[model samples]
Target: MKKLLFLLLFFPSLIYAQNKTGGINWISWDEVEAKMEKEPRKVMVDVYTDWCGPCKMMNNTTFSDPQVVQYINENYYAIKFNAEGSGEVTFRGTTYKNETYDANKAGRNGTHDLTRAIAPVNGRIAYPTIVYMDEDFGILSPVQGFYKPEQIMPILTFFAENVYKDKTWEEYTKAP
Candidate 1:
């Protein structure tokens, strides 16, 4: 009885310890707009769908990296948006929602209008896209795919420091 009690008490702590790692501070789009108005900061939106494998991978790996989490928390208003969710969001005086969403469809519901507006790559949407916006809510870029921590570090620094104005990505990457 004592052994079983010990195991029950200790196992939950072990699980909690293993899972208690730092991660990005994700906010909603409405909160981002409200916060930006008072104290402006660059916005980084993780445009993801529930069924995207790459998006889950990035959330587990890249976004979970301590350095990436700290840098993003410090420099940007991080938003984790479900691209197919039926939540209404207002940004820059325009309201966006998933008008044609089919909740019964499970993983294949209609995309949210905000995701379509922000992540359009030649009129197509891609999962695991990271959309960057300036302090004024102007889009900087929508980068797609699952990027490792090292691969995403430069992009984060470039935008955080506003280096895109004068330096091309090639020039920025080549710098020591």
Candidate 2:
């Protein structure tokens, strides 16, 4: 009975402890451009809003997974960007702002100009948007939805392995 009680109490913490999970290296957006300039690794930006439930879930579940974290941290310069933030960013000689940021409205969020400039089709501009880019910061894909760790594993690995160089997702997935 005592062992069972202890296990139940600590299990949650064990799941969340940030230790050697998959290659996820959480970082701020400001660091991404500089890091890319310095080393030029692939980049994966997690564009999220504070009130989005799925965004929170990814942080506590998918991102917390050891395999996901390890792979992301190893191959991509992972960044977390708050879509509705007033954080200053310089992009192509222009500045962007939320200007009218509202803290409410069914959890809908705003974004800076930089977000608009970098987002892919659908303009991302959505909660929990995952933007994948190549080493040169060229946009690859924008996944604007919730996904489990397993669901994202292949997508992440596909980009990391340079599979995009020769085959499409459909072709690669079908090729053994």
Candidate 3:
């Protein structure tokens, strides 16, 4: 009884803190949208397939960076979405799903409609795309590729600070 009571008192908080240790608090699309309705915040969507190598590397490095994690948590609702995974999402009025997904082909299933909608780079789909969006799900950019912590920080801050509003990325990065 005492052990049960002790766990009930502390286990949840411990797990919550542990999850935040060197990791971003990745929420779902539904949750992010719901939260945005009540309290608007920027969003970062990590669209990747499970079999993507650079995607795994990004998860192991950039997303794990302490500074990156803290800054994203403070200013954005981060979502780690699987590009070829099962799920239904209704975004901007239309519903999306992996209609061509074959359970036997989990690793290389057809792309989810949500991924098609959010992660195309110049009309091409790429693994490990990092999409940034405004408070109302308006896409700011769908930057595709793997990046180290140092490489991603500037991009994160560019959106976080609204620098993209006044200056183009080239101009912003070129300035001293």
Ranking by lDDT: 1, 3, 2
In model 2, which regions exceed 4 Å deviation?
Answer: 1-15, 18-23, 102-109
TM-score-based ranking, best first? 1, 3, 2
lDDT string for model 3 (44-139, tens) is 999999899999999987887778888999999999898998888878889899998888974688899999888998899999999999988899
Query: Regarding lDDT, does 1 or 2 come out ahead?
Result: 1
Per-residue lDDT tens digits of candidate 1, residues 1-176? 99999999999997656545456889987788789889999999999999999999999889988789899999999999999999998988999999999878877689899998999877888999999999998999999889999999999999999999999999999958
TM-score per candidate, chains pooled: 0.87, 0.80, 0.87
- In terms of TM-score, how similar is model 1 to the real structure? 0.87
User: On residues 1-176, what C-alpha lDDT tens digit does candidate 2 reach at each position?
Assistant: 99999999998787656353534678765688778788888889888877889999988789878788888888899988787776776544566677666656555555666667666465336668888989877789887878899998999988988998999899978957
The lowest-lDDT stretch of 10 consecutive residues in candidate 1 is 14-23
Judge candidate 3 at residue 63 and give its lDDT.
85
Report, for every candidate in turn, its global Cα lDDT versus the true structure: 0.90, 0.78, 0.90
Query: Model 1 clash tally?
Result: 0
Candidate with maximal lDDT: 1
Q: Which residue runs does candidate 1 get wrong by more than 4 Å?
A: 1-21
